[model samples]
Target: MTHLDDTESDDIGTLLGADGPFARELPNFAPRLAQQAMARAVQQAIAGRDTLIAEAGTGTGKTFAYLVPALLSGERVIISTGTKTLQDQLYFRDLPKVRSVLGARLKTALLKGRANYLCLYRLDQTVREGATFERTQAAQLATIRAWSARTRRGDRMELAEVPEESPLWPRVTSTPENCLGVECPFFEDCHVVKARREALEADVVVVNHHLLFADLALKQEGFGEILPGAAAFILDEAHQIPELAGQFFSQSISARQLTDMAKDVLTECTGITGAIGLLLEPVEALQDALRKLRLALEPLPTRGAFQLLEDRADVRASLHELRELLATLEELLASQAERSRGFANLRERAELFTERLERIVESHGDQDVRWYETFPRGFALYATPLDLAVPMRGLRERTHAAWIHTSATLSVAGNFDHFARQLGLDDPRTLSLGSPFDYARQGLCYLPPDLPDPNARDYTEQVIESVLPVLHASNGRAFLLFTSHRALRRAAELLQDKVPWPLFVQGTAPRPRLLEEFRASGHGVLLGAASFWEGVDVVGEALSVVVIDKLPFAAPDDPVLMARLAALEQSGINPFMGWQVPSAVIALKQGAGRLIRDVHDRGVLVLCDPRLTSKGYGRLFLASLPPMPRTRALADVQVFFANALSPDARDGGEGRAGV
Candidate 1:
């Protein structure tokens, strides 16, 4: 691999400058100083084989900042994004544009987890059991079958006709436990295999954090890793890495996995004579035990530590029965393993589940928190690690590649220590670049006066009442971002008839469709919870007001959080300030970032919680926000919007107030 020398690193600025090839070749291209600085930092990191934690503010064009260096570095690069949507965008849109503008001839491949690709073996199994499906599902299966023939990539993203939540997907897709790998008849033509093969030979591979961490955790041992050895690794939206690392490292077993295994066993029995008669009763008994366990857990809270199960006699009995049933099913499947490949896979799955259940139930180690969360019709058990730093650092050291972590909200109160600690980076090189959007001129932060505590029973109602004037001032082009779904629903109900704009609530429609209609409505008020806080972009005047119901904090009742806080306390750390506050600050930043996406974008941010001024620690949250002018009076908000809409407003006529 060729490294960028000092002279070549210096040229990165000129390459991304106003007179560069990008400006000449790409339309609407504007050179940004912050982006240039970030590109230089990334180039230096890559050339020196160092770890860099970069916090690029919104509008910094962080994608291009890292891309130009990665493309020019002449090294195999792996770019991991926070979501599959961003992964696709980076591969299909951003990478192509940057490569074309730079004239860099390099190969790039898009690789997702096996769940995203269609499995020929599973498709055949589903086809054999077509009559067992409902009419709607059967039709959906037919559509997928038709698509499977012509779709070269077999990526589910290419087929938007079928809803992502359709039950038909799991039937046609393969999981790690069920995949036959090289033993399958369709091994030569397997979509996941073909994609991984292409990725191995490509100069760059685009993947999401789940797949990246899955690889680091060695969760794909059946098929091996898809990410190739790289000279440099760039993780976009790096703030998500800490939490995602914990999830990937955790041991988990879901009721859905057990049910799926049972279904697969039934499907496998279809081809072998007398197999159904022998295995059907064990599968049914396992499913009945699972249902009983879920029912026994209904009286407790939705989520808590494993100790909760020990206190309830009925729950304990149900769990014991479930474990016994799983063991029995494993024994039965072992008898049928020699029948076929499908039976062999089923037996392995049953054994894995049995072992996982026993481990989770028996684990009492302080390093890992054993917990369970019950869903509407299912439940999942997890034994998550108390800290991710050691394992994450281990992975980094094993790679022996330069690591670049960049995100819009990585630092809190201008400090990257919290993020660095989470990923176990000790005294790492860091860069913090402010956005060039001129937030003081383009945006105003409005902290509504005299709101009750966030925990008040009628707090949601008061929040709506406080923001009603701001919503009216902005003419209903706003996003009501809540920390919890309960508040979001309450606010939605309160404003249903009060405001005249088209109300787009989160649960009413798919997120993409809601965003599409919201953008087109011109005066839509969209209300959403956690998922809407980040990864949402609405530029221009279409979204002018962003109302946050409360300071974005993790719920104290969360099982994992409780365990982590306890662990931190034992280590002589103030968990509230050291952990909770910093985490909330990053989350609040992500929510506030939804405003002023572009330089010309103008908006008012209404913070409904009085804690910003009432609490001593609130300063940390306020300090982390962009340098927007702050205001307390609703009249200033009204005037700002009024002036923003006036014909002469382009020259900074909006009102400004100090924090």
Candidate 2:
């Protein structure tokens, strides 16, 4: 066992006081297994020679477990979360409570991406440009203007009622691509800069994974360090890190950004005379040509693999034409005109695009990665991911203090190979803590007998039929987890009339509101995909059944997924074992975890996927879950739910019996 050093012991001893901000006595609260795990993590972090991968189970009070060690150690720590919601939770709620309780008046700050903070220069520019605003947007701007006058923090979350998707958000926000940085007239008043300055001074900093990865990508280039060289770094929700890192490591130039750059330039250069316009005409012509090329590619069938510019000669010819156009644009930019900014921006875009295109053309059939992605609305584009493992390694190295990475399902059974390999870490100190809940006594994993294949057309109907009786037995308290949104919608429609519970679809009332209603209504059944998996905490009888429609496989047709699979195959790895199976196992563990959140929580889990029963690979997935009582009979599930939903049920009172 690792002993707390003098500094750690002193900090903890001081905090366990009668007059401290702690609402409860620390010793009275039973010590948790997570505390031991966290203690070891702190030791490892202080040593700064090894990495740690810890899978602290639910009910571990995992947040406070790591926070205590981090605070007591007195190190500059950076905490990166998977979602903005968690970031807000940590910054606004968790940190303050911990500080007050611990009697540690340590400075702390919350920093988010530039997009989350209002860019005063951009806001002023948008208002001055007389940009047309929709009625709702105009009202939002008026509200923001009023709030901006009184607000001190300038954090967007301070605004009481801002919708996440408000058009006003982007109008007031800035991106790295569009930001003029220190050169801006409003640089001193910049919210992003102010937040960063606060973070630099703070002992602890909270940020989301996206911003953390962005800073890593930009670190050598000297933009800004979101996750600075900290004494300790704790990455909560570490499961999502790989995919997010993939995005950060990839190069993407969006159409919207390109168009925005052009518009900004046009606005900046509007009052310039004729010679500049004539010279800049070629820049516009080149943009139009590139736009037409993208338009042509849009209608093609959605297929795997990046589309390289066919024929090196054709690509070279286009490059020559673009070069000539940019040369003219440079000449216009050199002229002392009001539109110089526009010309300069055009020139920048040309140079950037040419470089990206050259890389794409040269990377075909090479180890260098290239791929295409299309939006739901049908706009298609290309990307090239830089070496991912490098930034991942960089993050692990920079976080100097204790780093504890936890998730509900960080391993496949007991092996951490899949998750470890993805994070580019090899067998760092690893631990897997089992859930305190006794799944063998309280819950049952039910797989219906003789079900049709999950990929068949009639699978949705079969799944709904299989779970309706259990839903009826439990009187609603169920979540129908689907592999896809389409399946979720279909099952929701079919089960609407058949089940006794009032159904809540995922998108109907927003996630938090729907969950609130589910708890309030009591007889509530929710059907959702993806987001329904984890971070859902419904204890007691309110959630007594979890019906997973099928194995949650990453969509095979997703262009990025396909590309990754191809790359894996070329490396002589089984895509299923190395990629697809592990991903599904993690997701399934998330869904299954929702059922038995607390000790008193008892539920029936119905996995409708036949593959779990028929294939040898299924054992790996099963071993990843809680040690639940397994059942194949629908009758057994009905009985289990009946007992779970009853008020008189007594096996797991106060949520500790399951343990």
Candidate 3:
């Protein structure tokens, strides 16, 4: 726990009240009672050292509500966000404004995942070896080189002109298995180490959930972690914690990882050192084995558990052969004439890979779920734990700090039990605030009728047809969020030439760029998948409608989901009724939340899935949404838009026809 001064100062209400610091500091500030109330509750939670789960609705000024108390509390704090975008916003925008207004000497630092920082050693290695890149990437690498000379933080985001999916990024950045740590030649000038030092000295440290979980994993393993001295913990966008925690708790080893390690070792042998003659044949053999292993995996399904994969004779044989080769390579590296750092790194990686594969093959317990997932490049075998409650509890015990978990959609139908159970929070006080926006006047829920089931082959086409009238009424400032990538692509193709507005697809550019294009175009239809469902905000005129093609539901056949359901069934629970329905309801709530981002913002919510109305569980979805005007007719949607956008309408510029 942080040392407490115990000097009470201005109350949360006074700081956030009308004519308070905000009203005095910012000209556009509006007083929101719900925001003020949430701020007070957060302060109380922090002061009392209690656990709190809060759901502050859209337009609640939730960021300020939490940040104000956090800054004034005088405790060393670690604020974790769900995404990098939000992390940047807090570090760059929100925190500064609050500090200036309060005149508090609050020092803040921003830290990201390891990959976000450049590895001076890796970049030097690439340059020393004269590695070749594709033409476009070569140009980008030149730019990176120019920037590296001037970059103070060595953060990739500093290269704003570089595309997010640039192929050169992975080559320059370091991963856990590849990083040489303190043994690196460039240790003193390490960007990651320097960032950690700065973070530890600051009053507030900002990080994303991935890095935070990495810290937690290290703590669990009794290793050094990155977070500064922290007492209170604030998790914004708390709904994402469950899925992310599942990933961090799992152990994964991919064929591509092995292949990359082999290439790195070979490069070290041939480029940096003069061990090419001794290692060339064995390295080639390892590379061939890895390639054959990738080929063997190509026959399996895109994703499934190792149990299902074991039926493939080719894959099993390849895995066995790869294991044998890894063992032999480890022995061969062990016998190297000079025990160089490169040789030591390769041997360690080889041993770790062998251990992970052995675990994937032999690991079996009610506690762990082993699976394999195939991507465009390669397949990864995972041994993810089915249960996280025990680990979560351990984290809480270790931190010994107040925990405040807050998000816009943490509950389903006013119930936080699902989230609480997943997080293993013990009877935490819960708060659920409806959006301060007048939903009755600011939004309309449109459920189109006579649409085919979501599983139907032509449902994407039907969804297009159903929302055409609304898009026409609103002039195409909308987000068409799909549950699947295939559906999103299909919808994009069907609407390519039909809609009068410019169309933007998710994969055309980075998500931030697509959103910028959407906002800058003034009116465009953005087609996206699950990634667009949450943490996206477009206020006023640029976003007027959110179209969800179907209820967001995880595939039951997913290996992890299957294992979870099996675990629940063993405990005499119905997976769908108890867990699946509530989870979908929470997701549907997040989609609905994309509409009405502010007090006066008016928009329409279009859900094309007939199950939202046809199924018995549909009521659960409806109950989870804000209290608003609900209609099934396209005519009502058209009417709402026409009235909202009409120049004569009273609310025309009062944040109508927008988010």
State the weakest 10-residue window (summed lDDT) of model 3.
1-10
Residue 302 error for model 1, in Å? Answer: 0.5
lDDT of 2 by residue, 1-659 (tens): 24457775544433333343342644434345454555556455544545677787776666776676677667788888888889999888777767766778798888888788888887787778776778888888888888877777677878857777676788788876566666678889888888888888888888888888788665522226545567767788998887888877766545455456555556665566664366456547757755654554455455445544343345345545544654555455555333454344455555665565455545554444565544533333456453356666766666554556776678888888888887778557787776665668877888888789988998899888877777777778888888898998898889877766688999987788899998888778999899988877788777888998888888877666776777788889988788899998988988988987765677788888889979998998898888888889878876665544235444344332331
Encode model 3's per-residue lDDT on 1-659: one tens digit a residue: 22223333336767787879898888888888888878877887787777899999888888899889899889888899999888998999999998898888977899887789888888888877776777898888889889888999998988887777887788899887788777899999988888887787888889888888877865321124545357688999999998989988888888788888878877777654557777778778877887787777776778887786688888888888878888888787777625677777777888888888888788877688888887786778898888788888888888778889999999988999999988889799899888877888888988888998777888888889888988998888999999999989898889988988999999888888899999999789999898889988888778989999988889765898888888888899888877898889888888888877877678889988888778899888898899988998878887787676555564345435441
For candidate 1, report its TM-score: 0.96
Per-residue CA lDDT of model 1 for 1-659, tens digit only, reads: 33566777669999999889988889988899999999999988887889999999998999999999999989998999999999999999999999998889999999898899999988997786656777888789889989999999999999998999898898788889999877899999999999988888899888888998888776563434545368888999999999999989899999999998998888789869999999899889888988999999899899998899888999989989999889988988899899899889889999988899999988877789888999999999999988888888888888888999999999999999999998899778999999988888888999988888888998998888888888888889999999999888888889988999999999998999999999999899999999999999998777989989899889877899998888889899999999999999999999999998987788998888888889999999999999999988888887787665454453354533321
lDDT of each: 0.89, 0.71, 0.83
Off by over 4 Å in 2: 1-23, 26-30, 220-226, 271-291, 308-350, 376-380, 384-387, 394-403, 508-510, 645-659
RMSD values, in order shown = 2.7, 4.2, 2.8
**Top lDDT: which candidate number?**
1
lDDT of 2 at 119: 81
- TM for candidate 3 is 0.95
lDDT score, candidate 1, position 645 = 48
Winner of 2 and 3 under lDDT? 3
TM-score of each: 0.96, 0.87, 0.95
